[model samples]
Target: MTDATALVQHLNSDFSAGHDAVPARVNGTASPAIEQALAHPDLAEPIAAALAYAVVRARGAVRVAELGTCPADRVRPLRRAVERIATERAKAEAVCGPLRRPAQRASHRLGRSLKQTPARAVLPAAHRQTLVTACAELGLHADAFSVPNQRNGAWAQSRGLFGSVPSEAVRELAARDDTEFVAALLHDARMAEDERLGHHLIVERWNRLSATALAWGPYAIANAERRAVSRPLHARRDVLDALEDAYEDLAVLTCRAGEAKYRAFRLTCQVRELTVTGKRASVAAAAHRRAHELLQVSHPEELAEIAEAVRAHQVDCPFRADGCPDCQRVVLKGLSGQCQEAPGSRPEPTSPPQPTDASGPGVTYASFGAEERYAVLNDIPGGARVVVSDAAIGEDSALCGYGWAAEDGTTGHGDSMASTSGEAEIIGVCAAALTALTTHANDEFLVLCDSRQAVDAVQEVEEHGDVTRAQEAVLFPEAGELLTRLLPYAHRITVRWLKGHIGHDLNEAAEALAGLALRQARGRIAERTAHRARARTTSRIATQYLPRRSMPHAA
Candidate 1:
């Protein structure tokens, strides 16, 4: 059997036998290897705690498995129990100072006899204080546990004193084949305690260097190069080879960062294409996962620029034809060629634009069929028409707009000038619901909106059944007004949250309409401002140089 397995069996037997002195005896008397481990002051408590915790966890796992729980589900309760015990121990230590070393106390008392001692007699003054402090903190009376020989009942009942070990450390220890599993168990204990035992400094320094080298950024290459040139040589050939492998990974990452970015962009495009074409959810999700993996190592700003270029290409060249110059430019140069400015004079791109209107010529909106609607509104009565609403804010202007599209092909959009996107979203949902009420007053309407805040606000009003209170609590007067108007129709309207920018057909259409409305509103504002400017200039010139007849001869 593995050392860990044997240790578990030994602990189970000792605990089952109700031996008050097992905590002390198990460390040294169980096996020669364990005895040698306990000889080190740093390893004693950690080793004992690790063994006890492992036994408790193994027992719990076996119990849970017999109840037919899955592996993932089985781990949660054991983890929670370990965490609880650790928290309690920390609190107790904070109040009464740390628990006395049980192994040391037992050794001094036994004096080579190694006979079983009553657990109550074994408790040092500090341990008693800890138990009392723990009980007081938990609001339990201390007098209930004055029994003569209850073998450290509190510690045993709490399943030992160790904290949880991270899965990464556990997996790494398990992967090593040269050492006994007991050594792995010792390593896990030290890791959990976060104690700096021998060789810890070397491991910590190497980890820091590896993290810096692997972190993808401007300094990654330099850090990798420094480590490759200056890393300390180890006596073991295997350790040296491991360092070499890490250096190679860093080298590969640094050398291929640009290529990775390009591949990520292509993958993103593929995912978007698949989503917009009404492909299977699983297929689109898989593509998205692949794209996300590549995105992790890429620079955020670079990815944003590429995404913007792709979006612009989708907007300007609706066909997205392979041969189109703009499409080719986006693919080859990673920049949109739509601007007339020379390459040197072109302004650096800003933040990515919001999702554009999908109603544009080349963009296709995926259908949200009956199956999708049913999935979202399984509780709501059937045969209700679906309306998806979205809002957009101008990038450079304060202009905002709301758009909504019904599955019945009815669509509406309007600008809410000088309002924030949050207010615009509520206004959009209100407008969509009101429009639906006008057309199909008797029909139930399910409004799928992207803004959770808006949905929550509406639900709040419904729950409280007070429009005046909602008006007082709302941030924007316009939103309050729109919501008040839709309040009476609340029974017919159901507002549900839908994630924005995914390939939902009606939602995309609404998003596109909202964006289009904002752009048009911005254009109109610009036109009106230019007209006033021109008129003012004309009047100024007339007064200065057009021979203004001395203010009409003072008439």
Candidate 2:
């Protein structure tokens, strides 16, 4: 008869004996127990026997389906954990390889000179994307790298990576549930690309595979499921490369942001010197050095990227600009500086909301763009406008007991503006005498410290009323002694401490006067220039409250 009759006959024969002697398989081979004993190897015989006895396992189809949903749901996280790692890997690989033709060409030339190497797993989303990418370009398989771990009974992760559903998985899931196809198709259109893939394929795969594993008992399922859920070795490596590339944009952007901020901060501190010296060379040098440090930290994984890309001959620039040798392109270089053309000849195209790496340190799309980053740097060192008045500089002895009021000389001395000079009266002199000039200057007046250490030494000298080795040569000026006598009159004198650049009209006036006096002291007798200085300082008063970079554009 047919195989069915034979299987029937065997089961009937065994059942005829007793339930305890149930046939392990429907087929008339060895009894399940005998086979389990003879197979010697563990579990193989049992799983084989259990499935073979499924005829005995036959149950209402409805019941089986109901049970299916439970186990399958349990295994969902494990599968998802695997796929998430894959998507990021792919993005990183795309960036590192041939984003531009010239880069591609260079990669190709370099590849020829080098031996093939293995690829490593990379994530464009992580800190080491560049390194991960370079390994990918060199035929190295970066994505193959994964260290999986379980969390909770239901969830699992690989590489601290999330689980994702790819497009193929979605198709598989949809095909299995054709009854829901129309609804899913409609939903797919409204979903994001990754989310669409996730709902159909990723969720479906997880539901199916995990349920399958759980049905066989979670223990057995877990043991065998490793292979079923694993990323294909080649695909894994490819994904890792993509992941690394994802962060390339970020890596470059972060370095750029950091370097920009560092330079901006440095500039704000030394604007006076920088403007006067016209030495922008140090800015570039510092930028380059800072960029390098950032590369070391943010792109540790990308150290060999250039060399690897080169040796693999992966570089291909469509612009044909790659062919222009450095010396050959001197005329061209004048027009385009730096690489004759970008590593790729991508014509600069204006695109809405231009895409940028979401990876850099201070690179926020909303508030932390290049401009804002510079502002933060500028804030690092404070800038202020102040009215500094020294009594000796006034016109008392015409030489010694003099005070220079900012803009005291705006009109005469021919309309050439200069600081006002005045002789201090005895009362003013009494307040200044026996005083620690530096000490009183700082304590009585808040100095926004151009340097943190100027007055302490000066202040300490007179606190003990003792002159030091340095002070022995010059006696404390009478003006300082007078200040010591009448410091209590500070409430009367009204020495106001103003923040730098704030719109305090007096501060602006004082600063303007100071500038005018300095110019005058240098023997410049230009009246128009002095008047203009006051206007400039006044104009900037409004900008004092805005961040440094914004100062130029503040209302």
> For this target, which candidate reaches the highest TM-score against the unseen true structure?
1
lDDT of each: 0.45, 0.30
Predicted candidate 2 versus true structure: per-residue lDDT over 336-407, tens digit per residue: 432223222466787676322223345333454532221212222133211222222211001222111111
Sliding window of 10 residues with minimal summed lDDT for model 2: 409-418
Query: In candidate 1, what are the lDDT values of residues 236-272, reduced to their tens digit?
Result: 2343343334333333332222222222333333322
What is the TM-score (0 to 1) of candidate 1? 0.29
- TM-scores, all candidates, are 0.29, 0.18
Error of 1 at 81 (Å): 59
